[model samples]
Target: MSDRNDNKPQTPWAKNLAIWAMIVLALIVGVSLVSGQNSGSDGTVIAYSDFIEKVDEGAVESVEIQGQELNGNMTNGQAFVTYAPDDPGLVSRLEEKGVTFNAQPAEGRSLMGAILIQMVPLLLLVGIWIFFMRQMQNGAGKGAMGFGKSRAKMLTEKSGRVTFDDVAGIDEAREELQEIVDFLKDPSKFARLGGRIPKGALLVGSPGTGKTLLARAIAGEAEVPFFSISGSDFVEMFVGVGASRVRDMFEQAKKSAPCIIFIDEIDAVGRSRGAGLGGGNDEREQTLNQLLVEMDGFDANEGIIIIAATNRPDVLDPALLRPGRFDRQVVVPRPDIEGREKILEVHMKKVPLAPDVIARTIARGTPGFSGADLANLVNEAALLAARQGKKLVGMAQFEEAKDKVMMGSERKSMVMTEDEKKMTAYHEAGHALVSIYEAASDPIHKATIIPRGRALGMVMRLPERDEYSYHRDKMHANLAVAMGGRVAEEIIFGYDKVSSGASSDIQYATSLARNMVTQWGMSDKVGPVMLTENQQEVFLGQQISQQKNVSESTAQLIDAEVKRIVEGGLARAKEVLTGHEDQLHALAGALLEYETLSGDEIKILLDGGDINRTDGPKPRTIGPATGASAIPKAGTRAGRSDGEPDGAVPEGA
Candidate 1:
């Protein structure tokens, strides 16, 4: 710190003196030009006496005045009043004014002298600036040569700005990497017990799980020199540049000995050997080879650690992950509810958040969201609040932002037909009704027919808080709920064409059902055998596995299981809608009439309440009424809209 201040050099006095001298010289030249002008003659007029002298007498023309000027023929020594043809000289017809002019070749130094004089100061300034530039650039050039140096970042001590406190979700993975951080901080302690540092660690997960952020924390904690580079950075256009960079990086790491190097998206250079070998000389493959060689060559005692991150770790070269190179693989998966709350707190630091906004609730609403998404959610929430001209991010804004991110901005202007609005309302209500009656189903968090994203309607639900793993009952329940919308459309509207809005829901449900039969132990015909190996989807920080588990006979059974799951749900939806046929017709008519209905308004119609009572749904209740206006308000009214009161379910089954 002392040297930082003391190193400030005293600027050369001669440089300052030279600059001041130039400024003074310019002022002197300017003053001389102004003083040399004529006295008593108005400066406004342009009287070209020299031009008048040069012109032939035959070419003379009488002066003509323009723009309030009184111009006379040029009279040289006296008033010969000689006029030049080019001038079309000042007119004598105009009203006389005090304007007069005597142009004297815009007097100053001669052309050569002015240019020479001006060049003196400019040359001095340019010379001084270039002198400094070369001095700085030369120093910079020396550092540039070091580009071949290793870009592996470091994290030594556990005393970094981010600790386990800053991390959320994927607890198992976090705990595992924490130990590595501890080992680096005290290698001697581990060595005393014959425990040694692994040469490298690979982090494999889906995108947005904060893999890179964790690496940064490691660097901060280790308090060691950290070199950060992309796996892509190791590659170059030249045939051997990749390998050369790899060698230079390792050499630098050897010098810094106790440092850390982080290579993100290692799959870029670490793809399977011979996978893309057009020849053995491909730049990416060469980089991977050099990396493998260096990792194997570097001794454990050298104290240099390599950490690489990739979302597509499955495609990486196996040699890079083998024992000699990356000894451990850490998986950073999506945050759970608790993890999400912690992450929310971390990201909410600068947001002016409402005291009542609940992070846990928001987290529950957002399943499968990565740290990056949560961060984005928080930012979107802030923006939402700002749009409302609010100082703090409120719960409503958070919910709105969540909807915007998950779905899309409200298409308030996308007008729907009367029949379309009613269809959407019943379609959405059907999902809520089936889920409510199903014993194995999760509680509905939100159910709306509001058109959002690509959906004309939607319903968000939550599973039992304690369910860590999936079950047969839950899976069946999900399938039923997913089919509820289509079933509602058919049961009420009759074998009518279904909208493609439920395409995603069906796809998700189908995948889950397939997994249940083919992979998870929930299947009746197939046992718990893995159908596919775990593949790392790096961006999400999760392990995605596939299955080839079922035999041909069992494959038929699996398809049956999937269809059975979907049909059961659809049948349940049909049964519910048919049971309340009168109410269904009334609600649909109301939806057609209103063109939009909020959850409360729809509930009122179902509850057979008064139409004038427009109070929205109670906070605790969720149903077709919840946020229903998002649809009905958007179209031409052509059907009945029944605003009914809320009601409880019948006594028992």
Candidate 2:
């Protein structure tokens, strides 16, 4: 049944041609009827006096009268027509002249002409109605009467098919889904061992973690029919429409048994019922209820494996997460070092990479990059190489691409005063100095005074390896590093002359300090208890019903603790900069000269060594002393205090 429906031919052209032919026929018939009426009078015209004179002279053979008009045949057999004035003696005159005449009624329409004239309007109306109905039926799986039909599309293997080999960096998720594919390919193999086929699998992860890609890979590997749809496709403004769509979708799936149904971003329709204020949405709740039944209802949906992807599994309904509905929950997390290296290799296959480009090194530099981010990085590198008119993407291009993705594109065209440049140099140098001097902080990756994105200057740090959890000493070191810019400005330019470049720096430091005190329980006074309230959505009923966890006294204590943490970091930064003023000045001067410097260059400059930059900055390998970190750029513009750029900060920066 499904195959026949899929193979059905569309006859829009034929239908339109038929309608046009009918209209043309109707027009021809109408034209012929009008022309026939006009051509009915084929005789020559004669004056009334001439016609009467002919009748009196006995020259007329016969005459026919209709109202005031008369038609007669002369003795010569010629036809003539004439109009007569009101003459009551015409009949007697005709009789005396020996002319035969008769009275006749006026001509009326023929039966066929009348029927054609009436039916033309009805036929035109019917044709127009059918055209509109077909148009509705052909649009986005919708029809004039099929408003509740499912919009799920059956994905074919011919359209950019992705196999398991194409998916990288998410081995665990792939392995879990592979079993389902195996069962789909040979269900009897699993059945021999008393194994039951899993009903569904849920792919949960952060955005860009390759959840949807993995789902597609499963379909490709299994070589089965794939039906793909979004959760939003099941929902509509009208009530009960979503429920009907769910039923229709499952019916289609049943026809193609042993197929996969992939639903991306299922959170849109599977959110918990009665969760938000005003008792939640009735229509959405009903839709979710229907979906729940369809997944693991009384009647089994055998041979049909459901695959769904969502980043927000926390909001999904509890019933949907049970064992029978979604038998497996696959977590596709961001790739670590090895996984990133593999992912980079996968994307680099399409690009012409130079001999100097090493995937492992680039992967180490990008510690927490996802599969999608790695692909973007490779693409950006290729674009950079293309812009420079290079035939191959080299290590230098990859380095620059990584920097652009991690921070932002350099704003070299932005005009800055000489004084602002010097200040920005000093500010960035301070951050580098603190990161270098502090033992617990990550190593400085690079320092630059060039304007990038919204920042006037920025100093970056990278971990020796991927650091999942931060230690207390590391957090304290990070706090000092964050305060480095402001502390440098206060010491060099004095408190009254300090600029607003430290606004983002202060915001970042304050947020870190608060999280440490209220959330992390790093504060001695706050202890291990969480004093901060869980942030809920504004529309959620719990947000309105719940009160703050902290009292007035506790709130004050938290504020004081956050302030103390920030000030301690400031004092530490001041102490470090005060002791190493000469090195700070040296690093700042190098930044002003080169506009940018790597960690090795900064180290060389601090040690009173000159860099030979005639060949450009040399590529440095990631080592124990080399790493990367994201720091918000300081704003230099006057009367603009809020310095945070839109989407400038990276995740966990």
Candidate 3:
């Protein structure tokens, strides 16, 4: 199937070859006729005077005159020709010279030869057109013959470059897939115990989590044929084309039993049917229906395993996820600390790195990095090293790579005015100070005035450990942190003088505060009821917007509650900044001087001594809590609030 010519419609090579042969034959015959005419023509044209002079000298041996033309052999055995003059004594003159002259009619081109000469090129052109037309028809693989063919690329064991060793991170997912590989290796072992192998396994994960790599590993480990395709490959604009292709792919898979059929991004075709603004595509629906029937119809022990990957598993059709279809669901979640370390190690093998670079430390700093992200980090670090003419990638390069991956590439070319630069420094300084005083907030990692990504300046925080959930107090602290920049601007320069650098901060702060009241049930007026639908669509993998079910009065109350939470966070931030007015100015001054500051540097200057090695806040507990029990009372230590000793929402850096 990999041979391109195999998919092309068979052309009548014999007939085309015959036509080309005929064209060549005609060309050869035409050339032969032209050659015959040239070879049989009078040897050379001579002047009539020269002809007479030759005759007078008896240099001409024999001559033949035909109408106005003359031909003869000279005494020296050289042949020549000349136009006969209007002399009536020409024949007598020749006879006197014993030239052996005779009257002969000039031969013209043969009727068949003239026809062949004129028509050969035309025939050749027609033959070429026919030949190309046949090739075009075959090359396109269209018309009736191609509609049902599978678009899958078949890979053999030899073609598999990635084995299980090449895949790292998401160990649980790999373990699940290893079962499928084992089944392919020895189907009889399971059969003896009455254990039927799963007909299909579905890999659910965000992009770049190595789902496809795991698929390749399965094929390589099992040493079997692999049929790989994408979900979109099954569908076409034409109705029934997708269904036809589904059937054809399965047919091909049956021939290569004990094989794996991997479909990347299955959600493209497997999306929930009959949903969305406009009606779903008929062709895609038909393709999905055919797929359902095929999976249901196949025997579980057939040694043909189908594996599919998609990030949007929430939006998939329920029928596709049934037990008989994709019996095993492998969740390829983002790697944790240990997993990230392993993934980094795998990627670091190919890169020349300084001995001081520690994968574990890097992994600890990167909380949610997937395998692909780690690989990219390694590559970016290598690129940075090469740019600096360094022989090996160092820790500094890795740090820069991580910053680039998280924030964005540095925009050194971007020109910033003096006013903008000062504002940005003060703005980042505000965030840093707030994060430090707010017990619920994560520790300040680094604050920078240098432009990176879209931000004019940024204040980054790093959690001591991975944080999986956020509580009410932490949510409030985050809201305050987001608004800190604006509050600082308001404090330094009056409200009217504040710049627009806090636009993004205000937006995020408003969202967080609103979610606290509406979704987290932290508002006192709205009670503990869930008011909004935050549920995500299974197939589309997006949050579905649900209308508010509360009454108008209740809606007003919700709005007021949201505003109150935001105001509380804002008030707390303003208080913290106002009390530490001197500290804010000092931090801003340091940022302006350094253009960047590490967490320890900021802490050292704030503490007015060496950096304090203090313990971080306690981890925020998970699960939903009822009522406004944890809501802090007004003026409760500014940012800490009056809740559990460490009731702040924890966040991953």
lDDT of 1 at 268: 80
Q: What is the per-residue lDDT of model 2 for residues 1-653, given as tens digits with 9 covering 90 to 100?
A: 12433542364778777877877787787778867654535678899999888887899999889767788899999988888899999999999988888997756665667777778778778878877777677524576567678888877666687898999988888899999988877889999999999989999998888998898788678766788999999888888888988988898889877788999999999999888987988778888999989888888888888899999999999999999999989999988777887899989999999999988778766776778888999999999999999999999899888877766686545554566667777877888999899999877767866554454456766565666677899888988987887788777878886766666666768888999998888999889877765343566444554466677788888899999999999999999999999988888778777877888888888888997787765322111111112542211101112345421223234
Ten-residue region with minimum lDDT total, candidate 3:
623-632
Model 2 alpha-carbon drift over 4 Å, by segment: 1-122, 136-140, 276-280, 360-369, 395-409, 490-498, 510-579, 615-653
Off by over 4 Å in 3: 1-145, 156-160, 237-240, 271-286, 298-301, 314-319, 355-374, 413-420, 490-496, 533-548, 551-553, 574-582, 607-653
Superposed on all Cα atoms, model 3 deviates from the true structure by an RMSD in Å of: 10.1
* TM-score, ranked from best to worst: 2, 3, 1
Instruction: Single out the weakest 10-residue window by summed lDDT for candidate 1.
Output: 644-653
CA RMSD of all predictions: 12.9, 8.2, 10.1
lDDT of 2: 0.78
| Candidate 2 global TM-score | 0.75
Any idea what lDDT model 1 has?
0.61
Tens digits of per-residue lDDT for model 1, 1-653? 01222332344556656656766676675555444332223323444554343233422333333323323443342222222344344322111322244333333445655566566567667756654554443311123343344444333343445656677666787777777778877778889999878888899888899998888777666645666788877776666767877887777667666767899888888888775446554777777877887888644436778888999988877777888588889988777767777888888887988888988887766666789988999999998788789988888788778777766665554565555656676766766666666687766565555555444455555443424565677667666766676677777667755655455455556776677766776655556654542333444666465444446676676688767666665676677767877776665555444433444565566688745635533222112211221111101111112221211110000
Cα-based lDDT for every prediction: 0.61, 0.78, 0.73
Error of 2 at 155 (Å): 0.7
Clashes of each: 67, 4, 8
Residue 215 lDDT (model 3): 84
Error of 1 at 353 (Å): 2.1
